[model samples]
Every structure is written in structure tokens, then in C-alpha cells.
Target: TAAAPPRIFPQAQHFVSKEFCQTEFGIVYPPVISVSSGELIEVETRDCFDGKIHPPPNENDNNEYNPAQALQQMKRAEFNPITGPIHVNGAAPGDILAVTLLDIRPKGVGVT
Candidate 1:
């Protein structure tokens, strides 16, 4: 007799959601929210600034600038851009979507 086939597991789809976790000092690290076919979750992320603020390399900008203006500039570039809205093949409205966090890694917080 032939050997029995191994059990199969269903594959999960991923969706990239955005959240304004925080914005300080001209640096911004947007939140990364993920959703699968069965749940809602928040994924771990590194600081978007990566310690590149304070003495902005571009144009040698100083700290004297308005915080709001600097933040607006960051926003203009659409900082912390999200990945996607991946729709599962069979997902529909009112359907349960289970999003789970497989892993998370975050770095220093943005300093204004």
C-alpha cells in the first residue's frame, strides 16, 4: 500500500496597515499594522529615523527650524510608506481575518 500523504496547512495572506505611532524631533516612525485572513496584529518595526535627524545632512538644516515645518517636510515625502493591501483570494467583507505577529523588531524612538 502507498504511504499516506502528509497533512497540509493553509497558507496565510498578509496586509500592510499604517498607524502614526509617534513623531518627534523631525523624525517619524510610522506604525506597521498587519492583518491576515483570521486576525488583526501589529508587526515589529525599526525606527525610521535611523539616527539621521538633528543635523539633517540635506542643506545642513539646524534645530532652529520650526518643528511643525520640519514635520510637514517629512510628511510631504510620505515618510513610513506602507507596503500593500494584499487581498486574500477568498477574503470578503464581514469575514473573519486572523492577523498574527510572527516576529517584531524595533529600534530607537524618533526624537524631535
Candidate 2:
């Protein structure tokens, strides 16, 4: 069977990174990306494990730790990391923000 063609968003500005993430906080952080009102943008994200839950290629690999341990560490660091708090230029307080999800393509197969 043939794979379906990937969805295309011509006007979307793409953004992806494992760097700009945050845990629960009392104050808001700065926006990672800025877009104008009504502009389309795509932000790539990883699963809650941040792509670390799976085992390494070799069972003997000492680098990989247990999933529980990894989860604990991530909780202490930053749990449930999301893409961004995308800033919409000219949007003010009490203004509504609309988000439309065009597509979601998982990167890899996993048991989680």
C-alpha cells in the first residue's frame, strides 16, 4: 500500500526544538516564537518522555536508564514539555486566541 502524502501548510512557519520547554511555574515565560494574528504556524513536539522512554539499540548499553528514573528526573527538571507560548503580535489581554491543528504525525512507534 502507498503511504499517504504528507499534509502541507504553505503559509505556516515551522518551528521545532527540544530546548524551549518549561515545567509548571507561577509566572509566564517569554514566547519562543512570534506570529501575526491569523498567521499559520506549525510547532513540533516530543512525547512526555522527551523521546527517552525507549530502550537503546543494544541491551548491554549502560547509557539508558529505567523509564521511571527518567520520568522522575524530567519531573524535577521539566515535565510535559510543550512546543511554545506562541505570541500573536498585537493581541492584548483578554483577547481570545484561536488554534487550529492541521495535522499530527507521530515520529516513531512506541509502547507508551
lDDT of 1: 0.42
Q: List the lowest-lDDT window of 10 residues for candidate 1.
A: 5-14
Error of 1 at 103 (Å): 1.7
- For model 2, residues 2-108, the per-residue Cα lDDT tens digits are 65334355566655444666654433788888788777776657676667676544677666567667656665455466767667899898998788887877766
Error of 2 at 90 (Å): 2.2
- The C-alpha lDDT values of all candidates are 0.42, 0.66
Residue runs of model 1 more than 4 Å from their true location after superposition: 1-69, 74-80
Against the true structure, candidate 2 has what lDDT? 0.66
List the pairs of residues colliding in candidate 2. none
| Model 2, backbone clash pairs (residues 3+ apart or across chains), number | 0
Q: What does the lDDT read for residue 8 in candidate 1?
A: 29
Worst 10 residues of 2 by lDDT: 1-10
